[model samples]
Target: MKIILPVAGKGTRLRPHTHTRAKSLVQVAGKTVLEHIIERLKVLAADELIFITDENGQQIEAFMKRVFPDLNCSYIVQKDRLGPAHAVALADPRIAEGDDVLVVFNDTIFVTDLTRIPELCAEADGLIYSKEVEDYQRFGVNVIRNGIIVDMVEKPDTPVSRLAQVGLYYLKDANRFMQYLDQAIQAGDTVKGEFYLPAVFMRMVNDGLRFRAPEIDAWLDCGKPETLLETNRYLLEERHSCQGDLIDTVVIPPVFIADGVTVRGSIIGPYVSLATGTTVEASIVRDSIVNADCQVKDANLRFSILGNGVRLAGSPRRMNIGDDSLIEMDS
Candidate 1:
């Protein structure tokens, strides 16, 4: 099977931080968003990994090469930036005929047992993962008949189906998928000037392909600033470990302190992640994520996110500060 990741999004919602770095590279729970996604993909053991990135996606390429050196991966440039269908279509040359394809979006991290994939695909034409969410209008919901997905309605007025597509798919016939994707693009079957993968899947559904919508274990979105922090809080529960020896520092449970992090005269945690090279002194920090190489002195922070190389002093408040910022709050 080939794993295709469309990671070319500019992340317009995650401003400031995204202005200087890719959204997938944003740090949360002491790991990058892409790293967390790669952790999930390690179970797949795919034949070849294809990343659809933009022309200016060198940072992603470099980070992947440096961190995941042994990965058998190739990068495809999505020049037009049309939509999901266009992104996956760029990998057509890499996907051979009849090869199984797993398409995953990079803006979110999902937890699903992929061990049953091969077995499930053997019986079905495709597989879609979804989570039952209360906000049905916010997503394209799966319309299921009996046991298979019959249609997908985007932002329906009524609560048709609570199963929201969590941006993960497994197609048994990659060649057929590309055909539908091409058809969607050529027929001008676009929402607003961009082709989407859901339309292609709908076309495939109309042509007698069976798609099973399984219940996903979890779907953690890192699309925007608020969601990123929520994802951080979620990850910290599973990855709670500290590699630091501090003095005059108090640590609560469920926090991640990376190596080279210094915490002195402070109480940190309940849900927090302090990245490497960060120092928290004379402060009380909780429910937040502080990125690498930051200095937090004489402050109390909560439900905040500090990007890399930020320096904060003399404050007690919440923030969404970005990289390399220096803030000296009033006493």
Candidate 2:
């Protein structure tokens, strides 16, 4: 099976960090979001990995080459920010007519066992991974009838079904998917002048294609700073361990500190991940993530996220700083 990862968004929600790097490259729990997704996909044994990227995707390309040097990968530049359906269509040339395709978005981190995907696809023409969500208005939901998805509603005002469609999808036939996409695009069937992937699925459903919605174990959103920190905490707690040695610092469980991290006279914990080469002295930090090469001294931080190479000193109360920033508070 071929896997297509669409990572071409500007990620406006992730601001300062996204300004410099792709959203997928944002670090959480000692690895990039893209790395987290790639690690999960490895179990599927994909034949080739296709990336649908934009102009600002150089970092993604570079990271993939550096990390998965031997993996079969291809890149397709989506020059227009048309929509998700359009983005998927860009990879049509690479996908064979009858090929089974796995499509995953890069904005959110999903944790689920995909071992049953082949079985699900064998019964239906397509498969969609869904999660039970209370806020159905904020997501595209699948309306299932008799164990099959009958319709897909994007952000329905009224409660239809709790099964919100996450970004993972599998199509049994790539050619049929492309045909539906072309019809949807030609008809100008867009919501707010942008074609959506759900629209394509809806079209397919109308044409008598069967799709199944399966539940996922975990779906973590990393679109903004707060959610990113929350996801970091969740992931760290799941695989918690102290990698580096600490001296004179109050070590708290459920924290991740990378190699070369120095902490002295500080209380770090409860949910904190410090990247490599970061030094903390005489500080108290909790529920935060400090990226690589940062120096935090004499500061009390909570619910904060410090980006790469950030420098903080002199009792800054709390911060949400970005990369390469230098801040010194008053004594």
Candidate 3:
């Protein structure tokens, strides 16, 4: 199977953090968000991993080379700022007609048994992974009928279906999907000056192409700040361990304290993540994410996000400080 990841979008929702770095490269639970996504797909043993990046995608290449040197990956830069279909279309030269392409978006971190995908999609034309969400209006809902997906609605006004289309899809015929995508582009099938994947997929659905909408276990979105923290909490619940055995610090379960993280006389977590080179002294931190090279002292930080190289002092009960920012609160 060939894997495709369209990661060229500018994360406007995750500003301040995304202002300095790519959204996917942002640290969560002591590791990058991209790392978390890639770790889940390592068991699939795909043929080649392709990343559709942008011009300033040097950081992505460097990180991937350093972390996954032997993964057999390739990178292609998408110059234009088009939609997801445009980004995926840029990789057309690399994929063949019979190749099975698995397209996964970078904004989401999914938790499901990806090892069983090959066996599950053996007889199907394609697979569209979704999650059953209550707030169906916030996401694109899939209309399934007779055990197959017949239609896809984008953020419907009414509750047509509860199956939210989680940005994960498996295309059995790469060539056919590309052909349809091209047709949509040629036909000016766009929504507000941008081409959408749902339009192309709906076209295919009309042509009698069967797509099985498989419900995924978890769909953790990292698009915004609140959601990003929520995703971090979910990840910590599944996989988290302290590399450093703290003595004076009040360590809590389900928290990730990376190596070189100094925690002195502080009450941390039930849900907290601290990266390396960070020092927390005489503080009580919980439900927060502190990046690397930060210093927090005499603080009561909760529901806070201190970016890289940030310094927090005094008694900031709650915060949303950015990178390299020095925040002094009222004691």
Q: What TM-score would each prediction reach against the true structure?
A: 0.97, 0.97, 0.96
List the RMSD of every prediction in angstroms: 1.1, 1.2, 1.4
Candidate 2 Cα errors over 4 Å, as ranges: none
Off by over 4 Å in 1: none
Tens-digit lDDT track of model 1 for 84-164: 888988998998876989999988999888988977667789998889999999999899988799999998889989999
Candidate 3: minimum summed lDDT over ten consecutive residues — where? Answer: 238-247
lDDT preference between candidates 1 and 3, better one: 1
Model 1 accuracy (lDDT, Cα) = 0.89
Worst lDDT 10-window in candidate 1: 115-124
- Order the numbered candidates by TM-score, best leading: 1, 2, 3
Candidate 3 Cα outliers beyond 4 Å, as residue runs: 245-247
Once model 2 is optimally superposed onto the true structure by TM-score, how far is the C-alpha of residue 227 displaced, in angstroms? 1.1
Comparing 2 with 3 on lDDT, the higher-scoring candidate is: 2
Query: Taking the tens digit of each residue's C-alpha lDDT, what string does model 2 give over 1-331?
Result: 8999999998988878887788899888888899999999999888899999998668878999999887799999999778999898888888886688999998889989888898877879989999999999999999999889998888899998889988999998988888888888899878788889988888889889999998999999999999998899889878676777587889786888898899988999888889999999999999888889999998998888888999999876567787999998887
- Candidate 3, residues 1-331, lDDT tens digits: the string is 7899887877889888888888889887778889988998888788888899985488788899999988988889988777888888877888976788899999998988887777767767888899999999999889999878989999999989999988899998888888888998899887888888999999998999988888898898889888888988998897678886465988777899999988889998977999989999999999899999999999998888888999888997788777899887777
